[model samples]
Target: MLSTAGRHIISGEHGLFRDQVRKFLAKEALPHLDRWEADGIVDRSFWLACGGAGLLCPSVPEALGGPGLDFSFNAIVAEELAYIGCNAGITLQSDIVCGYIEAFGSEAMQQAWLPSMLSGETITAIAMTEPGTGSDLKAMGTTVRREGDDYVISGAKTYITNGQNADIVIVVAATASEQGRKGLSLILVEATRPGFARGRNLDKIGQHAADTSELFFDEVRVPVSNRLGEEGKGFPCLMAQLPQERLSIAISAQASAQRAFDEALAFTKGRRTFGQPVFDFQNSRFVLAGLASRLQVGWAHLDWAIARHVAGELTAAEASAAKLFHTELLWECCDKALQLHGGAGYMNEYPIARLWRDARVTRIYGGTSEIMLEIIGRSL
Candidate 1:
């Protein structure tokens, strides 16, 4: 097991905080996993429980109704949750969405939204990927047309996390259609608006406990004050936030890889073949040895990235590299771990099944491996 006692990046306070999170999950999340997976969404009561535990929006300022903690606290929440195979979207709330609001939201916008978000009474999602636009932000078709002091939104977003449960959505729309990427703006839209609608809760191969959906805006109108940051500056805003967002995914991916390795080790030792433990077989031991070596190196690099991020020294390209490495490591570890389980691994009754399923998407989201390479290649 990876020991926390000597990790320089994690101080005593972070260790204690992790313990509290683990205990909370044991009591509040573990027992409900099966039900949540079946329902395709976690209950709102769980979100309230997280808020009461001070687990949401750890980095938001006290003035904005948050704990005023740093990014390390957010990392603790992500690591603990992912280690246990929980896929709740709490990190999206704390790590990604809160930062955008804190950075660019106006006084009125902050006052109106941050407190409820901190309390978990409000769920937020950022709509970036449009119907045919994959990683190309310049190609999105969503539009925010200004008319008589109201901005009307019209477009659709798919594969959105927190979509089915989002109380408010930060929509990325083209304010000046001819300008391409420069025309995009981030506009906050309430879910209660007349033309706002959520399509079906998407059925996915994994991460069933977290709701992903299709979101539509048919001429949904909001006041001019709803714009976040400067008009036509949304692309840069997203670019600035991508580093930390990618780092968060790396944190979760690293912890999850460790969990997969642990599960495989335990299973191989327990399951016997030819009157001997599977772990005793030469091929099994070799596979595990390779995974173990990679995991040790992965954890070290992850800590370095985390420390760099906490110091505000991690660049977009570096964060992209970390995300690429760790997520790919997660896939390899999960795949090997499941192979060690033989036929039982394919059955949903085993924990490795879910871990394997969840690991597949890590390489695809938070920017794909190909996109990460492009970003890094440009830096080179």
Candidate 2:
């Protein structure tokens, strides 16, 4: 348990939730990751299992057909998923994508989707990145134009998480292209709709079990009711919710860093070199000591971020900073842990190698480290 303010950050109810998630992952996730990695996607059965375990969209209120939990519960699920390197899209679904619907969807729309989403029967993807744009929302080229009572959407999205299996997509497109960012709006695109298509499951360097793909919309049409919030107000909603999304990235990075450090410590203590255990060597001891110090500070930072987020007081800059610091730290920890493994680390058979690969994307996705720095710099 992470200690903060003279007590563990996780309380009684939270502890029970954590235990449930830990046991679920142990039985259903950790064992199958190897096959999932090889396949570049997780099975829908596992996603259904996660839903059955109450591990999706946890923060949605009971009135909205959720468990009425807060964001900390969401954080615990992310943390436990990251701990075992489960690369499926649960965190993305539960933490980032679901908020769009809960916060902006109309009562009818929420009723239509939230229940199935919480049940894991429906998977979601958010289409924001395009072939030509990333990080800059203003650069999006997808357009959704109103035609009488319907929206005609035409554009393409790439690098979309959950692309292959999404039952619904929250599409960010320009409803009024001349207004720049103000022109942007989010619309719900169901997978079975006409002219909606999934393109390549883009080959990524890591997080293979989480399907990332290119999506195409050729004059796709949906009722105006499918629009989230009001016309021309989507960017604000995105801005409001993105802090939590970045914090989710930070959560995953923090947990993965700890996992790598733990794995390296165990590996070094057991493996022999020069007639002694690697942990007995001065160099190994120093490296582990340095990582130990960083992990202590990381846990503190993460706890602070989670508290602020759950209280709805975490700022965009703070969330960006958390993302920037922890992801870079994750890369450093993974690299160092791999180095400690010497030859074994370079091999795919070791978890550190996969951890290092996966860490690379943390800095790239959820706003790149450079983007996070820019977001933070504006506050100065």
Best by lDDT: 1
Error of 2 at 42 (Å): 0.9
RMSD each, Å: 1.1, 1.6
Question: What ranges in model 2 sit over 4 Å off?
Answer: 1-7
Error of 1 at 282 (Å): 1.5
State model 1's lDDT: 0.92
TM-score of 1: 0.98
Q: In order, what lDDT does every prediction score? A: 0.92, 0.91
Highest TM-score model number: 1
- The TM-score values for the models, in the order shown, are 0.98, 0.97
* Clash totals, every prediction: 0, 0
lDDT string, candidate 1, 210-295, tens digits: 99999999999999899999999999999989999999999999999999999999999999999999999999999999999999
At residue 138, candidate 1 shows an lDDT of 90
**Tens digit per residue, CA lDDT, model 2, 1-380:** 22223335778898788889888899998889999998988999988898899999999999998999999999999888898998899988898888988889999999999889888899999989999999888878999888899999999999999999999999999999989899999999999999999998889888888899999999999999999998999999999989999999999899999899988998999999989999999999999999989988988899899999989899999999999999999999999999999999999999999999999989988899999989999999
